[model samples]
Target: MGCFEDLSDQELITAAKGGSDTCFGELVDRHTTTAYRVARSITGSHEEAEDVVQESFLRAFKNLDRFDGSKSTFKTWLLTITRNQSINIVSSFRRRALKFFSDHEEGEPELEFASNPLSQEPLDAETQLSLKRQYHTMDKALKKLPERQRTALLLRSQESLSYDEIATVMDISVSSVESLIFRARKKIIELVER
Candidate 1:
């Protein structure tokens, strides 16, 4: 089982499909952080992101038999599931909120971005303040992006997925992914410049 750590995602999936729960667990351990990041970027709440990750993994586990490695890598497939699940949860929440408040609604709920607390070096007060301002500005700009654009940008920038892989996860063409990311970056720059 210790050797499972050396196996690729395809190997892990094969072993998991062969009734090795440990292999599945190893897959979970390897991919959970990226899953959570993808989920968090969509849902904007830690709790909601956590829920999305859990649900996505459950669905992935159940549908493992349907996964074809030739079609997509496991990470791409899993992130697609995570993205779909996050969108569903967010849509459900919006529906319920609309039902609850009809006439006097103000605007969309404020989204909370995850902080980078893993930095090892301490920063001076001025530098820290400058970084905080930049992050806040970026977050505001990101929140303004349309869902598809935001998802595309995050997958490419944060997850470091290639355009082809992003297109696969997003069910769009490589050109479409390129266009989305281009427009997203353009919009963010415009927003920040303002």
Candidate 2:
């Protein structure tokens, strides 16, 4: 375990492919946080994100041999898998929700963000209230974005991935990533201002 801790992701992948379970475990430990964050960004629910991450890792482990370092780094590849799994789960959930709602003659289900605990920093009540309002507004604006634009923005802003890494994860050209993010930001500002 100590030796595995010092190895790079590529090294871990090679060892894992050679039948080292510990190496694969190390890889999971290294990327689980990022994978969970990516999943949560898409699914917008902690429980769903956890399930998505678990299923993604299982699929990645099963298909380890198909990974090619020449095409993308392990993190990028794993995130791609996480993103696809999250989308699939979200789509499935939406389909089920729509069917159930239609049968019951109920309106569409609304997704709500879990309220954040108050900040530890000392702040006036008015300031805190204003911040919460701003957060809610921003969240609504984000939800209004097209899927690709929102994905590109979240990958860059939340995960702090480089343009090249984002391009690989999203399977788009670097220019396309740039365009998507730009449009996303512009749309967010427009929505927020109104």
Prediction 1 TM-score vs. true: 0.82
The most accurate candidate by TM-score is 1
Candidate 1 segments exceeding 4 Å error = 1-3, 93-95, 98-132
For residue 138, what is the lDDT in candidate 1?
Answer: 80
Model 2 spans with C-alpha error above 4 angstroms: 93-95, 98-135
- Please give the CA lDDT of all the candidate structures: 0.86, 0.84
lDDT of 1 by residue, 1-194 (tens): 44357899999998889888889899899999899888877876677788899999999999999999999999999999999998888889674686578755344344334445697556666776777787667878898999889899988898899999999999999999999999999999898889
Tens digits of per-residue lDDT, candidate 2, 43-100, equal: 7667778889999999999999999999999999999999999888878968578667
Q: What range of 10 consecutive residues in model 1 has the weakest lDDT sum?
A: 105-114
Tell me the TM-score of each prediction against the true structure: 0.82, 0.77
Error of 1 at 37 (Å): 1.6
